[model samples]
Target: MARPDEHIHIEWRGGTCRVKWWTGEYLPNGRKRYESKGGFLDEETAMDYGRDQLYEIRHGIHVSNRKGATLMTEWLDDWLAGMDHGHLTERGYRSAVENHIRPYFARKSVADIDVLAYRAFRKHVNGVLGTGSASNVMMVLGMVLDDAVPRLIKTSPVERTKRRGKFTKKKKKERKKDMAPAVVDRLARNAEIFFGFPGYVFMWTMAMTGMRPAELYGLTREYCYPNWPGTDPRPDPDEEERYAEDLERYGLGDDRMPAIRVERQVQYSGGELQFFPPKYESHRTLVVPTFLAEMLDKLLASHTSRWVFPAIQGGSLGAVNFDYRYWRPIADGVAERSGPRVRRPRPAIPAVPTYRGKRLYLLRHGHKAWLDEDGHSKFAVESRMGHEVPGVEGIYSSVTVPMERAIMKSLQARWEKLQQDLRETDS
Candidate 1:
């Protein structure tokens, strides 16, 4: 009931139908490749399999005969070895696979991972890690499955939950955490009192510029341009107009000030501290106020090491070192002093929000907020923060000299106020 050259044949073997098929096309050497996969209880199923194979072969597609019995752990090792992401990204992926995924899915077949299994895995991870960290773990898991493709699995099991621009329940409730400017001022002032100039300069620079902690640690004397009359690397397109308007108040060409070129960031990988490109390759130059420039100069003059904020012994300062030794003590001290209105002497307080369990990155967030409060244009703000503005805005807009002066003036006002407060306190 079939053509003589059908390229497919069915035969009964061991009480089941065995289907054998040839790929329709001849090989480069004028020979055909054949494959056999069978043991169908019904001849119809075997015939159907043969038909699908023929269809795929005619379309010039390589049909995968893989049974997908490869273990998840085995596949992950191979996938990780072939990954081309950055060192930090590679570290994160490896961490997720080893710490979260492998413990449960190691021996399981890669094909067995479905949405249900992933959901259960997500729930387990959420229990042990914070919500954000759990989400990142799931993201890495999804990437792994995506790489498997049709060879290992028919389709990726990790279906995107929603389309872009669509908000979920969590999105509605999520808030941008920040400390008040006054709180930042107090913290910066206290940092100097407790740990001296390094602490003060570090705190104030982070508050003013919104540089990432890694960028702050990566700051070197060479990159700190305390005096530059030339225009910034990313000059705004409307600089001429903005400059004209600012001429009356700020005076043209008087906008030159100190700047820091954010070229690289410090990363802890393979149990060692090293420097790498900033996140999103956001290489930028940040203009700063005069007071901050003076402070930076002072800090640099005081430290013999290349790092603006070197460790006590030497080399780049670690995040753990900064947090435990400097940031935590200052935060704890502030919390202890800022108690209830009751005038009675308070006992040793055990707790405060600890900046709502946020890390040093919050200073960057606070800086962005400060920019927004001062009504700086979004283009300038995003540029300063090393964030790419999406769509037409990013392509069309640029950072201007006028914009820099405006931000500098705004931050300078805050610095003057902070200095006045510190002077009053010291007196």
Candidate 2:
């Protein structure tokens, strides 16, 4: 009988046997491919390695056994081609792959990206792009590796780190997103200076409603009122129309009962504008304070465009277009600009201490904080924020009419107190 080590070659070079064997694969040019392990002291060690390699291949766990060991760049392209995510998500993943990932890891075969190599890449990304971007890039890379498992890679090298003995140094403090009602009022008042009164209303609405920025940007006049004609009559989304309260049938129902439907948001994808349902499709009705409801009524009456918040130049605001011209000045306040663009253009707005250097998205965070402060039910709060609450609590609990009224009442009182404080300051 032929020995199992027949195909394995042993080269004696005055030290040890160099065992080499054919790998049952061919190059693109039809050349036979091989794998070798050199400097084996005994034929037993050499035989064991060759047998293990053969076993892995037969069991379909050998990475190089399939797809001829695809290169990282080629595999990334294949993976991206198969993605069916939303435009924004697609854009981000493509950006990570093209800008950060492909440049560093492209030349390597997918099988060669072992745990050590991937960890080094992680450290490099964190050092170069900072935490937030590194996190997103790593997410894409993890998914890419995971998809190649048992094909181009036997196991994914992505490490899901445990918190034990990690980062011994003191971490940075968590950023506070809690904003008092007065701080919101100040931001709104300054927003009027930079943009128009719409900016003022925009600030208030964002702070109070907790809608995502895109959701608010896509808000139309038709969807802003409690009686907005889209959904059928029902007390709760999961309930029957017979559960609709009598207070809902009449005009302007309860003063504290104005609701806005969160059906869609503005998405700029593929170099064109698009409308998509809210993130995670959390289409919901958000109750607004009576005063905010009144403001929307007036805003709708005067505004000619379909959008509740149109660009300063007209039409729907392109995503991130207003950052330099509108959001920065509104958030950080304009002190001065030293450029040769012209002359004395002092368009200054007082900076709110709470908002300085903070993102506009924090307003959404502040709304959640406010809701928590008011001790509202988690179900009601999560529903208002367009978030899916997890576990059995989410399954059983529902937002009722009383919860909506209570939220509206608290918000109205805050606004009233702010107004009172402002009046007192003037007096």
Candidate 3:
């Protein structure tokens, strides 16, 4: 039996019972508002359960406290502002939020985003932007929701979606392939024309030294001196002789061998060049060959700034600003002209979108390959490149300056041979 005034009633049959709540009758638009109380074996038990649920809802105990009206765009803005600035790279964070995340979900309300809608968004991102980009978007969304879980947001649709697949695996494959030395050289040669000799030097240095872009840009004239006192005191007989020969050959004093001291990096944050410690290995010194030393000296003398590679703008180089304005265009130009060495082709502008093209970060790869081919010990290579070797190997082995100098000499000799080959080809 049901009371007309009471919207909820319980019915039992043998071992099962149903508790039903009649929300209302059909409206003029043929829509119905109905609430349900699930089946239970005992009628009285079902009624009691339904009453408890109703009481919880009335008291706002079980109700979601999240506001349904908050737009995705608003949430994103707050998330970005609240993020740990030190943990996230400025350029990367900006790209993920502005270029990908906001463009996809800005107009949608948080409450309207269900699992199905999220899946559709993921599909759209994958189909149009590619899986990697879509995955990045999902990552950002997940991070935002993770922060919001304890606060205003109750559910995160990003958590429910499938983000990884063949596409992501393929992207990783492409990255590893791009790290080859030959690819780096082609990229460097092409970029040389636009960035000038300094740009070429900058790219090569990064490849060989494994110094971050900002560290390369932050190099100073004082840091490139031959007698850098901070260098490790290990002596190398072969390197000592080679360095002496180079100093004499160039009529340079003991001050000619280029020593690199990394005190800070130039980064663009908040629309300006900001000097900070290098992203990873911020406070270390590296020694380079005389040829690179001379190039750096000339660049420093001409630039007249604390920075080794100053922005064309008014101050020190900022990685993001410099890359966007200078490095990317040069990289694209190089990628267009470079291919397999078996066949030469005329240089042409790339037809692909600038944003969608690939540019190899060659300096680090070139350095590693050159060291490997020249048979320099891995410890020597790691030291010169300022990389911390993994595991017990790093703990037991120490690198001396003499060993570093020997490695540099070998690298320099190879570079000189390459220059001769280039000259012969030109002639």
For all predicted structures, in order, the TM-scores are 0.78, 0.83, 0.59
**Residue pairs in clash, model 1:** none
Per-residue lDDT over 192-297 for candidate 3, one digit per residue giving the tens place of the 0 to 100 score:
5554455656765676566766677766555554334333232446557644543443325554346666666766667665767666543665667766776666
Give the local distance difference test score of model 3: 0.61
List where candidate 2 sits over 4 angstroms from the true fold.
1-41, 65-68, 162-174, 230-256, 335-347
In candidate 2, where is summed lDDT lowest over 10 consecutive residues? 245-254
lDDT of 2 by residue, 1-427 (tens): 6555665676667778876666778889998787777888988898788877777766777755346467899998899999998767888999999999999987888888998888889889978996778889999999999998877777898988734334634446658856988888888888877657788888899988999988888987767773363333343566545324423532333343677778789888767778887888888878888899888878777678877877776677555576566787887888755567845444568888887887888899999988898899989999899889999999999888888888998999888998899899999
What stretches of model 1 exceed 4 Å from their correct place? 1-5, 13-16, 23-41, 60-63, 162-178, 227-255, 334-356, 418-427
- State the lDDT of candidate 1 residue by residue for 289-359, as single tens digits: 88888888788888687778776456676644777766675666534333477553323322225363456
Ranking by TM-score: 2, 1, 3
lDDT (Cα) of model 1: 0.75
Order of models, best lDDT first: 2, 1, 3
Using alpha carbons, what is the TM-score of model 2? 0.83
After the best TM-score superposition of candidate 1, give how far the Cα of residue 90 lies from its true spot, in angstroms. Answer: 1.7
- Report residue 69 deviation for candidate 2 (angstroms): 3.2
